[model samples]
Target: MFVRIVKLSFDPTKIDNFLSNFENQKNSIRNFKGCRLLELYRDKANTNVFFTYSYWDSEQDLENYRNSDLFKGIWANTKIYFNDKPLAWSVDKVVSLL
Candidate 1:
């Protein structure tokens, strides 16, 4: 499986807007082709900072999602709320306990 993690920092004033957009689009993301799982997390010390954790069947699957209009529309709306450039990583599992 391919694991994808993305860290995003949003403008404090626009946090709610970002969350709203995420809430609206998350289901589509989770159900996208080859998607296995999806989750969201927030930093304990920084409410404006968030992370997305997802599992995909393969890099190509993730790429398909990236190239989809769903992603384009969501990212276009989400980027305007960014306080910093998003950081992302895609990796294969070395080991897992669960």
Candidate 2:
């Protein structure tokens, strides 16, 4: 599986907007081609920070999503909420502790 992790820091005032957007669009995102799983995480110490963890059948699948109009519209709406540049990583599972 291909794993993608993205760290996002949002302006405190805009957190609600971001969360609302996520809640609204999450189902569509999870149902996208090649998506196996989709999850959202929040930082215990930083209320304005969040992370997205997703699993795909392959890296190409993730890329396909990233290049889609769905992503473009979402990203356009999302980037405006950021307080800092987002960080992302694409990785392979080394082992499953779970």
- Using lDDT, give the best candidate's number: 2
lDDT (10s digit) by residue, model 2, range 1-98:
97999999999999999999999999999999999999999999999999999999998899999999999999999999999999999999888886
- Candidate 2 lowest-lDDT run of ten: 89-98
Expressed as tens digits, the lDDT of each residue in 1-98 for candidate 1 is 98999999999999999999999999999999999999999999999999999999999999999999999999999999999999999988899897
> lDDT of candidate 1 vs native?
0.96
| Quality of model 2 by C-alpha lDDT | 0.97
Of candidate 1, the 10-residue stretch with the lowest lDDT total is 89-98
Alpha-carbon local distance difference test for all models: 0.96, 0.97
